[model samples]
Target: MLAIVSVTSPIFLLIALGFAAVRAGWIPREGALAMGRYALSFALPALLFNTLSQRPLDQIIVPAFLFAYVGGSLIAYALGLTAAAVARRTHPLDNAFFGMGVSMSNSGYLGYALISQILGAEALIAVAMSILTEVLLILPLTLILAELHDRRGRHGLARTLGKVVFQVVRNPIMLAIAAGLLFAALGWRLPALLGRTVDMLAGSAAAVALFAIGGTLAGQRLQHGLGPALAIAAGKLLIHPAAVLLMLFLVPAFDPTLTQAALILSGLPMVTIFPLLAQRYGLGELCASALLITTLLSFFTLNLGLWILGS
Candidate 1:
């Protein structure tokens, strides 16, 4: 528990401090957005390429891990939607963001740090699992849900899915993952110079992204709608993990590492992308508030999981 706190608290504090500095005008907000774009477009792709290309195929290709992780995420989506219905949330975009807040996690930045600290370097494979599931699987579904719920016009659904496909195709990280997998399958390796270049950029992605995530949340409008945001946060940090554990129990895998990792990862705070996706799809307020609340509350839930697992 102490180890979990020791590792996660400092990272979040640094993020919070960055947000506070930005909010106070010590760091220009525009500059932070620029940093975020660089991280997403350049640094993150490099990181994904470096990580995926070098990781063992067995780790990345585990069927059981995929089943547990992806299944857990789907269950989270259903649970979030159900909870929103019970709460009488009728706004389509808000509910979509609410559902995203439940299923999506800060897998790359926050998950990597916490899992590595608690579970060692081996945990990177689990992070890889999360990235693959999130980027390839859950993200597309969220976009589809957003479109179906969109009532802007008759063509809104087409526009929503079209933009989603375009963005997915354009995503550097997704491209890197696809390229790296192909290379891995064909047993090809990048030149040492290119590999080193990737390493340099990849090293900077996590911390920068975390800081930007904090800055993004610092500017949120959490004051207006507390109930739905907390409801979403509860689903993300608490209910999601519980659902994953239940799934794991029902399946009863021979090895527990993947199951354990998936459950813990599911319990994490909403990803920084929540607000971005919400803004793009029109659920900015809900996404922003959920991001802030979950980020703050994850300390307790994460530590509790660590205590249970690490014990």
Candidate 2:
């Protein structure tokens, strides 16, 4: 347990520093937001492209691992949707967001930071696979459902689907993943200067991303929607990882390291954008509150998960 904490504590410490910087007014809220944007838009994408392109395509593409992760996610999503529909607390329009909150792990930022620390470069294969699954499949499905169920949208279904496609098409992270795979397939390498630049950017990703997340968390408030937030957090921090673990048993086996990566990543809190998306459905505050609680609680859950997996 102490060994696990030794590995995980520094990551949380960075997160805590970000929160402190923002809360103490050392960094303005806008600055924190910009930090997040920088990490997401620049650092992370660069890191993904560099890590992925340098690896062999055979090692990068593991269909069984992808299936297990996605299968686990869908199970959690179904549970969230079922809870939203059956529970008295959640609003009906919140079904999509609720489903999303439980399923969408914070893979881009938090997951990468921790997994890379624990598993080193090998974690990238699982990270890339999970990120691709989240962005390409789960996210689109959630948006489609949100648009279909959300009565406030003036756009037609076709237009909404088209918009979703364009958004995915232009996503920097998605582009990075695609470009990385292409490079790997062709056995291409960047020039020395360019490679150095990518390495520099990649090096900054984990720390900056972790700090940005903490800063973002500092800004969230749980003023209302306490009931729903707790429920969502519980489902996200508890059920999601369990579902993923179960799928690991049912699906075709892969490398144990990749298996551990999948389990750990699945245990992460929901993505930071969860609340922003739920805002369209008038559940922004609820999701934000849920996110805050989930992230806070994940510290212990993550520790326990790592200890268990290691044990």
Candidate 3:
């Protein structure tokens, strides 16, 4: 346990420092947002590209791991949607957003940092795979459902699908993943100077991203829709990981490290963009509250998950 704390403490300490910095007015919320933007738009993508590009193509693609991760996410999403329907009886759009909040883990920021520290460079494959599942499958499905619910059958399916595809392709993270895969497939190596530069940027991603998450949390209020918010957080931190564990048991075999990484990723809080995504449909406050709650709770949940996996 002490060993586990030794591994995990620095991650949360950076987060705590950011939270304190923001709460103390040392850095405004906007400053945090700017840092987050830089992390997302540049640092993370560089890190991902470097991680993926250096690996052999076969090592980077793990089919069983992808299936287990995606299957678990889908099951959790369905459970969340069902719960929302029975409990809240809210608009379908709201339910879709709620379901998304439950299933979408903060893999890029929190999961990547923690898993990379524990599992080393190989963990990046799991991070990349989880991001692919989120970006390509879970995110698009939820957004399309929400859009359809909002539009009320006024829009055509083909157009909606097209728009979603376009948006996913244009995402910076997605582009980086694609480029990295292509580079790996071609057996190309980065020139020494360029590689060093990317390495430097990649090294900054973990701490900056974690600190930015804390800063973001400092701006969120814990009030409003407490009942549903708590439920959503519980689903993300508990049910999601449980589902991943089940999937790992049932699915065809995968690398044990990847299985562990997937479990850790599943146990993370809702993605940092939860509030921003919710804002598109005026569900920001509910999502923000849930994000804050899940993030706080995930400290304990994630530690428990690690112990379970280690055991």
**Each model's RMSD to truth, in Å?**
2.1, 1.3, 1.4
> Best lDDT goes to which candidate?
3
Question: What root-mean-square deviation over C-alphas does model 2 reach?
Answer: 1.3
Global lDDT of each candidate: 0.76, 0.88, 0.89
Lowest summed lDDT across 10 adjacent residues in model 2 is found at 87-96
* Clash counts for the predictions, in order: 0, 0, 0
Ranking by lDDT: 3, 2, 1
Off by over 4 Å in 2: 89-92
The TM-scores, one per candidate, come to 0.91, 0.97, 0.96
For model 2, what is the error of residue 245's alpha carbon versus the real structure, in angstroms, after optimal superposition? Answer: 1.2
lDDT of 3 by residue, 115-158 (tens): 98888777779999999999999899988887788744545688
Q: Candidate 3: list runs displaced more than 4 Å.
A: 151-154
In the range 119-211, model 1's lDDT, one tens digit per residue, is 666656777778888887778877777777766743467776888789788778788878777777777888889878888998888788778
Model 2 Cα lDDT, one tens digit per residue, 45-149: 999998789998998999889889999999999999888888765444678788888889999899888888899887778888899989998799888888777
Error of 2 at 255 (Å): 0.3
